[model samples]
Target: MGAADARLPVLEGGPLLRKAFPDHWSFLLGELALYSLLVLILTGVWLTLFFTPEMREVVYTGPYAPLRGVRMSAAFDSTLRISFDVRGGLLMRQAHHWAALVFVAAIGVHLLRIFFTGAFRRPRELNWVIGLTLFVVTLAEGFAGYSLPDDLLSGTGLRIAQGIMTSIPVVGTYVAFLVFGGAFPGHDIITRLYPVHILLLPGALIALLTVHLILVFHLKHTQWRGPGHTVRNAVGKPFFPQFTASSGGLSVAVAGVLVLLSALAQVNPVWNYGPYRPDLVSTGSQPDWYVGFLEGALRLVPAWETHVAGHTLMWNVLLPAVVLPALLFAVLYAYPFVEQRITGEWRDEQHFCDRPRERPVRTGLGVAGTVWYGVLLLAGGNDVIAQTFRISVNALTWVLRVALIVAPVLAFVVTRWLCRALTEAERHRLAEGVSTGEIRQNVTGGYESDHEPVTSFRPGAPRRQLTAARTGTPSRTPHEPEHPDR
Candidate 1:
């Protein structure tokens, strides 16, 4: 209605609509994470409207008649009512859970892609740290989100968390009491953690994500391959029509899959387990799949006694809960610096993805992480293992203890060797074209094979200048252009 309004740049219809996108499947992982986040926000908003975050105990009169006489926290009761009473609430809750799982998973894969490719080399180092922080926050969010349910499984997870916190030598108990507002799952704990799960962490993650994107845009994307391979140096398309359109399609696809899985594959059937009872310990208690490694570590530790400075040491509890978490965080935070030191190189720019084999050390670490996580995951199932083998839990724990020490070393060594082999293979292929498995017979009947040719260009090259050609210029005669054919 106003001239100023008319002068404003048009939105929803822009030049970006005409942009082209790259058709690489690898780029879809980030889009999957973004789409999952979108779904999470939508579902979270719906759930917040129906559920109360209060910690006060209340009598339940929900559709689930079995819970009618039971007294539970308002948060837990509201969650159950939402799932059974409110139409579509269960679907939304499941979607939220699935989204959280996907978000954590995508970020892990994304970081791995960056690491193997040397994308985190220079300016992107900050982004790597941001990613790592996001991962930590996501795990915390998952823990809090599940704990809000106040079911036996969730309660057990909370107990483990509390124990881990209180395992610190000097200030552990105080921190635990502070965090939980008293003993494990104190009266106010849910009320305290609800905001952290639903609001604070989400808000912080969004802010960090925004910053991550801005930095990515400012720096442009890291790409693979040579310069002459494309008209441009970038790997993917612009973030306008092409990239955005493809991303939208992929997001829809991923969201659809998550929704389908959520609908069909249920998680955390808290109702069956009922409310948290300190006296009741459920058989086969397990944390979420993502946190299983930590749980496994706790299971693997041997019961031990030590004395230091007139203080009795409970090594089993302290090592898994306090020392382990500290070590994990420290290693993650120190990775960028460690890598920088190892490579002893600095650059203003880095690529987005690198071949994993090219970065042997990083690949080795990844393998080592996998092995470590795998061993711990097995440790978490120590009971099952003992039952299956008809062996003692103590013996199982001891075996895992030894594995915890040795498995990582073996993994790192094997991974490093595999990477070296792959690198050598790549070099061989680069030196001689990739093998097609066809043998050629030479003129004299000897067998020969064609190989890849070496690259003509160096690692980096300078631009060449263009000049005009002289018409009818006498070509330089062989050996005597300056001597005039003498």
Candidate 2:
């Protein structure tokens, strides 16, 4: 309506920005990812100003005395200079590392939220795909950035990466060459990965994140059924002031926490590890948590090798490093479609979020997956666990092997039963309001709870639609829609 608004037509859609957002705490998990990424980008830019992405070896002769004249990569030396010489360099580097760990962690938890709540059904399936893609790109970005320091631990990680790539049967070697920019520990690796870590992967991550947010805005936020909310409408605070304050405050808090942690916590101490050597490696070295699961899998798979016609197949490496992770992610990406097919329903997919208790099978699957990953994660530190507990390493490995198979199946069965019980409990509570501390006498003189039927007890307006997502319950209210979760 004004000249300024006319000049910037994008501002004309300001009223559209008034869209409501659910105040649910679980909804903030995605925001954690977004804010942590902002921190990572800002700190990463600061780090890149001094980082040298060359693999050339140079003798270290810096203020730190331990490795005063030892040979190390230029990448590592620049990393040392950035750590000791540049003001706030250590803080920024640590913050960047911590932020990356948090970023991937947020994505993982956010994905679990979406899956358990059935938010990836129907119209939001494409959004799920986009979110998953962003997740994957962020992992790549983290790995590239992690390896740029060229420490001993990172060198081991790269070696594992190279081996995984070179295990792809026919074209593995060529792919590895392309990725590493030649043979193992290629001289040009840091140079090649510099652009990818700083620009390419981050660029893709930003673009994909933009698309994910755009799609979310288009569909509006999904929410649980609350008081006065219907299948056609979502209930929550609007974005203009209240939710905006919450978002701003959350962003600041996330940044402050990262800063504090970076100040106090030491992560990825590359200087102590010395420079990466192809022939040298340290004992008891481990990667960051996100990569830990894969490492665990690599350790767990039995050492079974196959030889056929002079070609070798290392099942131990291929199964855990390559095939398992691929199949797992493939299943995750395809789950929405698979569920849709099983249910044979789609017309009412866009409205209210499904309560986890309302979806027993999905809840069970989520639990099973969590347990499976948890076992593998613990197995990743098998050597440490054995040493700490003073047990044989092989014995610990065998125990983990049994646990991996047994735990997930046990979790699946228990979760499904728990979900069903919770659903039944909710029904009983709805039929009879929560028990007050009062007792009443029945006709036979037996005492019982004096309870009143409470329709709903959650905050905000009561949900009008009693219809579940899978089945259409008869509507009592005049304006209620015929379909469930419409």
Candidate 3:
């Protein structure tokens, strides 16, 4: 070891091992995403060993009594076998699904943290684009895997996908043909998607994830603003013994949580849904949570079509699924540059994170975007909600449509006001010091609370330390005399 270290100086303990990362809880989000991906890969590899990706029609003779003798595709049959025949196979399948869900969710939340805190500025803009790309790729990967089961629910999802693809202007049919390998419910989809799900998309994810992490390390981790933290210096634990240990523990915790969820929760029960038949449709069917927004959008859009130059245009399918997601991702990709151009803060390199309250417009915009997404997600379940409440589905749809338009505006206004109010309150607190609970009589016979002078205050400091009082000084009115233990 000593000789190798001497021969390769890079192997020796140096600045890389001693690199400082902020000990903020929000920083753990990226680590959570990484760990979730690791769980996904491990469980996915296990499932792949027992699963066969085939579309040939076959009679199920599996141990599951309900599915026995049912005519189904080889893909669905293998899924049932995995669930019942192979020990611990169902657990791995559920874990893989849960891990994918968590992975997408973590990346989303991590991006929000970065955006709100202004961490995606200047030197980190490229990383922001890469992170957004990761999100898009992850969504695709998830949808691909979701459809591989060949069950009724997934087949319905694929049908919708095919319709969306066929809605494109001139090349729609060709694109659909290329993807499904012939037509809707073609024999080639499962076989084709198998490699993409397990190989192509995951490979792209790993490559992009590698580049993203390299950029993070090369650019240095962004730290919250505090006394010792600055553009030139980061104040936190070293990478080797401290951050490494904590991060390792966090990975274990994440894995344990996934396993626990897999054990407790049953997800994507293909037996219950039965095999996909193009003529039959399942009731109360919905896509995964990550794809819920698009589903919601499709449900909300009124059926409309136009004929231009003898070709029919499907505004309903085209707008909601294709155009909306495209615009959304485009805006996300261009936000950092657009913000820089708008604010004209072009030159400075920011390493210390900005407080959300300090930037009212950005905070408000972020909140508004979140509110918009939440509304869409809720809309995705309008059918279930309506049936449960015995309300008119049309009424609920109209309500959601109105909310989709007005709610975001209202959220923006309220969020901006609150941010401004918080900023002013913080400024006032810094200037006037904290109030003591003790009430004392003044010279005019009026009771008033005393103010305690804070000894130290800094942005991102602990709340307890923010109210710490100075030892020697007691703030009082000029008319009052100093008293000990009064």
Candidate 4:
């Protein structure tokens, strides 16, 4: 048998694969995530074959040679080799980075869709937790992957992490030292993160994803629009050859596009930055966007010092790095419960979904979260903003602090209003015909078409059902000829 034929599944057919699935645009979010993961896997496989996950000092012998014999991590040298020497290696590396970026973005947007639509309610809470875990793991995976390069950027990030760790009281320094395997410029640091990047985090992510998919299959998908939103049944098609084929096709298409982009465009050109050097501080360096919020927080926090028992404490560092993140994650983990309590809904009676407008408070919280993240993202480029706008760094930090508080409230209020307006508009449309733009004179010489009533039905119900019967036709009498079946 031919290789392709040899892989065919042997099965007794129950239904035609082509006819079993729905082609809905909303389903594309999951497809995008899946596609990015496929690209990640492909690029990662190639990278793993060439990479040396070691932290030993090495002499760089690649295209870039500003500091050839400076003694950098083996992982960094291997990355340099991959970028400069191996055929198509740079493209693969860029593709891998882009894939990780896209994967995280897709999952985030997907979560927003779930939250706004109330898909995280009730039976789906576990799935929501799974998704949140996946998101956290994805972030960790990205951080680990970025750090494995041991570039100036990665080094800076490690320093930030160490700072965050050491910001804790008492045991903070010990924990940081333990994690990094010594002090700053610790030799064992990259070595520790190497396995975490390629193995540990990825394994955990895969396992969580497996569980996530199993739960999704069990619960089916939550849908939008029509009476379907009110009903518990999946308002969609079966998951068979149709969804599989289309999703597969989309994955291939997205991967192909990313591959082309990676090959044609440049990203993360760390060669220009040379290797990680402790003594030399590079200007205009920044962490990746995903980690920018913490950086922003660090910048905004006012410097302070306190002393107790002959030990000094820096409240600025502690608040931003340790307390802030703890607060954020604690809120995230507590949401399902907090919301359930506030809404006075018991776990057993909860549905798998909610319409965005149905839960105004939750939707508002989501919008506020986005605004908070966005402010931090902008703050990540604070230097750029200061340079561009001719402002001082301190002034910019103050502005960001004000914005961090105000922006989310504004965003929440505006989003809540807009969602309500849209819901009302939908309700109005269902109750009445499209509002006519023009008026016409009737045969009786009164304003006609504009004032004409197309149908009269109660608002918030399907139009097609009651359009003809006003309040809907009464059930036929038992003696009626139409009631023969009854």
Error of 4 at 418 (Å): 3.1
How much is 160 displaced in model 4, in angstroms?
A: 0.9
Assess every candidate by TM-score.
Answer: 0.84, 0.91, 0.91, 0.85
Error of 3 at 344 (Å): 2.0
Q: Model 1, range 1-486, lDDT digits (tens) per residue?
A: 134335646422333333333456665666677888888888888888987877788888877877788988787888898889888988888988988889888987887677666677676788878888888888888888888888777888888788777667778889999987888768888888878988899998898899887776655566554322232345557666567767778878988998998899997777777777777766878777778888898877777768789666778888876788779888977887777665664532444345666667788888888788788988988897888889998888888889988999999898888878866665554545434457899999899876533442111211100000112222221221111000
Q: Best candidate, lDDT-wise?
A: 3
> In candidate 4, what are the lDDT values of residues 292-330, reduced to their tens digit?
888888887778879889776879899987888779877
Give all candidate RMSDs, comma-separated. Answer: 8.5, 4.1, 6.7, 6.5
Once fitted onto the true fold, the runs of candidate 2 whose alpha carbons sit more than 4 angstroms away are: 1-14, 432-449, 452-486
Compared with the true structure, all predictions reach lDDT values of: 0.72, 0.83, 0.87, 0.74
Candidate 2 local lDDT, 92-192, one digit each (tens): 99999999999999999999999988889778999999998888888788889999999898999999999898777778899999987788998988899
Between prediction 1 and prediction 2, the one with superior TM-score is: 2
lDDT of 4 at 83: 89
Give the CA lDDT, 0 to 100, for residue 22 in model 4: 29
By TM-score rank, best first, the candidates go: 3, 2, 4, 1
In angstroms, give how far residue 321 of model 1 lies from its true place: 1.9
Candidate 3 backbone clash number: 0
- The TM-score obtained by model 3 is 0.91
lDDT (Cα) of model 4: 0.74
